[model samples]
Target: MKPIGLDKAEHAHVESSNNATVNSEKLDLSKVKVEPLFEKFVDFDTFTKSDFRIVKVKNCEEVPKSKKLLKFILDDGSDKERVILSGIKDNYSAEELVGKTLLAITNLPPRKMMGIESCGMLLSAICEYDGEEKLNLIMLDSNIPAGAKLY
Candidate 1:
């Protein structure tokens, strides 16, 4: 196979990104505006109120007629299986998430979405790449037991 050179536009795009990162540290941002979601900081007392537990995804499946919903059956150290509806179907496959250990926020009241009751939330990491949003569900190593409290 032959190597391809950047065809004008690609070269300029790469050059701009290189410069952007190099000069980012020197930029002035005292007047910069941020998204509302990132504007506030939660107090420690309020943050500690959330109950975070380690859970294993025993089963995972897509929610019918939904583009961004996935239904997960989690083993959270409880006698019954805990169900959580997540908006991560676009980011992960059912096969990729099954049998994986993850951190879940388990104290929230159940909410009905698409006619299903979700008992908790699965934490995920979000990032931006080339102006596009990317997400990955937070997972832990297998050594951690299910339902272990997160300190």
Candidate 2:
């Protein structure tokens, strides 16, 4: 096969390879295909306005009869407290997650998951590749104030 290029000889070779008899009277554009670009973009300014805070995990336990649910008691530096349920059981043990600091979306409307009311959503970095999943729980420095909004 001849090398592919803009030259007339290369175009003739490509046409012959497909068993297409090119007509001199008509220009064949059937072999060309145009693909639409797909992309999704989010505005950062809109995303930055969410109220996210660092909270200390005071307690962690597995929910009854649930394989992937774990309940957490988060202290956000006020008299009020927040309860969150996270699906991190497969990534870390209950004992390992207790007493850790994490980021949570504080202002989200409360939602019930698996019959338990969750007040907030814990934030974590997750990556999946080749049918395997990995989760990296966010950890905060001790100096960071509890309930401090993440900018």
Candidate 3:
């Protein structure tokens, strides 16, 4: 379905200028350019469906043959340890991430990468400055127990 005043096909690689015709009158369009606006909202039910849990990083190491992958063993308060692969090796080191309690989405389906099955995803924020990107892992403030559900 297409929304009102939001057609992408009409707006293409066309060039623009200050001069334009309007009913036999010259109009300066440079000052009256139409800037597209976007507003997307996610419903509450869809937002709450994600299972967020507190997991402690029991172990972390760089994935072999991959410069961007970092393998982590997480303690989710369960009997079996969980495995998560993150592409944050360029931002954080293995020694810095180990033994740290962080937020993770634990309900996602396991994904295999480089023969390793990642059971969860670590939460991080990407900050951009001067065309450079910095990824910082999200760490909770309080001393939350492992596998604690986030409401």
User: Which candidate tops TM-score?
Assistant: 1
Q: Give the TM-score of candidate 2.
A: 0.68
For candidate 1, lDDT tens digit of each residue in 92-131?
A: 7778788889999999999999999999999986644444
RMSD of 3: 15.2
For candidate 3, write residues 1-151 as lDDT tens digits.
1011112233222234655443343434443423244577878998799999999989999999997899999999899999999988777779967878889999899999989999989988554422445455876644799999988
- Predictions in order: lDDT: 0.76, 0.70, 0.74
How close to the true structure is residue 59 of candidate 2, measured as C-alpha lDDT?
A: 89
- Alpha-carbon deviation at 136 in model 2, angstroms: 0.7
Candidate 1: clashing pairs of residues: none
Worst-scoring 10-residue span by lDDT in model 2: 1-10
**Across residues 4-98, which tens digit of lDDT does each residue of candidate 2 receive?**
11222323323543333322322234443334445866689878868899999888999998988899988987788789998877777778677
In order of lDDT, best first, we have 1, 3, 2
Best by lDDT: 1
Candidates' TM-scores? Answer: 0.73, 0.68, 0.71
Better of 1 and 2 by TM-score: 1
lDDT agreement of model 2 with the native: 0.70
